[model samples]
Target: MSLVLGCNISTFDSTTAPADLFNAVRDQAIAAEEAGFDVVTIGDHLYATPGAPDEPTLEAYTTLAALASCTNSIQLSTMVTSNTFRNPAVLAKMVTSLDVISGSRAVLGIGAGWFEPEHDGYGLEFDAVSERMAKFEEALRIIVPMLRGERPTMDGRWYRVHEAINEPRVRDDLPVMVGGGGERRTFAYAARYADHLNITCLPAQLPDKLRALEERCAEAGRDPRTLEVSFATPMVINEDGEKARQQVEEILVQSGVDASMASEVFFVGTPAEVTEQLRAKVLAHGVHRLMVNLFAAGQDLDVIALTGRTLAPLVSGG
Candidate 1:
């Protein structure tokens, strides 16, 4: 598989309007497509803070509806939808509908819900972590079949659905990607069900995480290679490596990342530098897909455009 670049539109302030966010997504998707990116993805969060503003939380599926209409080639998906927010059968229908509208370009990336504050504010149950995992597993059991055109019926401890048929059945085999890094539970769920497995980028912890995933895949009688392993990192690109690092540092300051450790966590540098680092990580860790989250919201569109025009091609082997 070739390199993939996906930008996650995460707003750090509530000042951005939903319409503006949608327009940025449209423009960015077009730019990414024109720049030769293989996928355009988004993160799912229903919360508001300085780090995540925009009230009423621009629902992911609604944004996806607009995204489906705006872009043709780029695959659209959430980085990971929290399982606790929506009913599984309902969530399945939403994505399958997007698949239908997008001509089968939708992928579902889901996770056990985190962010207890969002749950509490939204009046949703903020279950214990263990219970959340069970709910997540139950969600997969209910969602996968429904999207595959099966009229699913399920009676589980946390959820109950009967003979639910997702209409306008997904136009293709919709990919289900589960996101997390829990050695025992998350990887096991992905090994058993996910088409792609995503984890946060923490280079120090990645080796052990992949090892755990490998073991889980073995226990599930599945080839770990059959599942795509992906990581998300923030990228700062410019002609000069140090200049790019400075740009990333500025963004990190805006995001309130600790001044000392921010640069170490992000991919901040020139295209060649980022590419060299990515190549090393990919080869060393067996990572096949990489999605870089561009924190360019309320920043320079020129930078975003340069990101696609310059970095996308370099990393995509064009």
Candidate 2:
């Protein structure tokens, strides 16, 4: 199969009125659809991170539901939702609702809860990584079956869904993509449960990550190829390669990553060069899909449209 091209609007844009941001995002997604991008994703967060200068962030589901009405072709999804943010049963129902509205164009991209600040700020349970993984495992048990129109009965320690009915499911084959790189637990879960695995790692680390995922699939008695894999990295494409490299540094520094690690982390170059880099660094290692966060390009519609029109054909051979 051809590469699956997905875009994410990361939480890095300037502060703006909520309505204006929503409109801008809607227009961006519409433009992505028109430009032949397969999916449009949003970061799942309660509020903007790095609160020094306010960043305009919205609740993922609400924003996605709104975008579902505004766009026709591009699939709507969370880059990955925090498993602790909502009840899994309710989360499944939410995806079902979106699927009904978007004509079966919704995918559940979820992960173990990570941001401690959001959990503390919102007064939600921010358990340790072990406990969080426990919760994530239990949540998926409920979510997966419920989305397939099954009333799940789970009496787990972390989350309990007592035969909850998931109504209005449009697609029985609704895609469930698990995101993370924990070789032991997360990859095991993905091998067992997920239809897709969105690998969040630096480009250079992809080969090892894919190998680890394959090992986990073997342990789970599943063929690794059964699960689709996608790499999530920042896209920093510019006409001038040096400009792209500089912006990549800025983006990395803003995210608390060392500036020195910027070169191996983002797709920094012109469109053709970026595609060539991805093909060598990521795709050759066996990842066929790329989920790029549109941050270096200011999350603007024009840049996103350009990314789709320019880079997508290189992989799809269109």
Candidate 3:
């Protein structure tokens, strides 16, 4: 039950190339591995935001493949990949290959997407919210069976598959982590399909979310604690709590999210203070895995390494 420290390599610069992004991720992965992080992750986005379209958007699988070849130990995967981007069967097969390439050190974190503009730009259907969730449910059914080395057919309103087979089963059953916090559908999906679960943007609701997950597990006839719970917090860590808060504020200003709201959601402080907060969060909510998102605000790789060196072992029981 050790804590995992991973980062999302989602850079917003249109001039960036896929190879360039992969190189940056590879360097971060190696640094994290050397610094004793348990995992490294990336996010998937097709179209850039309104003001951020020039953002470098690399395909998740390609970047992961490059990462697998460059790093030896840190388990790597997406923070959560959009379920609508590719056919579930294809995505499952790609993940299986990634697992093999990485010697079974891969996790698949999938999600029902949220960006309507990205969907419209890519010509993927921007279905109603309920329809999207339904598609996600069917996607899981199609993927899990194939990953288990079972060819299964599924017929759903959004996707149809017949005798889908994902060959070269991963070295082990690679862990599947689904992401979201909607209690009714999300927790239920985690109980039914995910080995790991990630949710963000609701630190205050974590305790309630865990309780809901427990209930869902019970209803699904699954052991409640069998699923691993992970949380991702947008964070800024400096030597001083006030300075860290200031840095987070600057990032907020850049992102137009109101600098005054920094302390409300993000964990910003010195390593000691952040560690205390992290421990409190973990103990209170039973979060076994934690990923600190440090995508922007000019964070150097060394800062993340220092985080692993100074903070991870302390909270993860090392």
What is candidate 1's CA lDDT for residue 29? 68
Which candidate number has the best TM-score? 2
Which candidate model has the greater lDDT, 2 or 3?
Answer: 2
Tens-place lDDT per residue, model 3, 1-318, is 222566666554444566566566677778777877777777778865324655667677888888898988788888788998888999999999999888888788899988888887778887888888988999999888888888888777777889987878755477888888888997898899988888765577788888888899999999977787778777777777787787777777767887778767787788887777777765456675677676553236776776777656764652
Runs in model 2 with CA error above 4 Å? 1-3, 50-53, 296-298
Write down the worst ten-residue block by lDDT for model 3.
1-10
The sequence of per-residue lDDT tens digits that candidate 1 reaches over residues 208-271 is 8888888999999999878887777667777677777776677677668775775467766776
Cand. 2 Cα-lDDT: 0.82
TM-score to true structure, per model: 0.89, 0.95, 0.92
Q: 1 or 3, which is superior by TM-score? A: 3
Q: Which window of 10 residues has the lowest lDDT sum in candidate 2?
A: 47-56
Stretches off by above 4 angstroms in model 1 are 1-3, 12-19, 49-57, 170-172, 254-256, 297-301, 309-318
What TM-score does candidate 2 reach? 0.95
C-alpha local distance difference test of each model: 0.74, 0.82, 0.76
What is the overall TM-score of model 3 with all chains considered together? 0.92
lDDT of 3: 0.76
In angstroms, the error of model 3 at 130 is 0.6
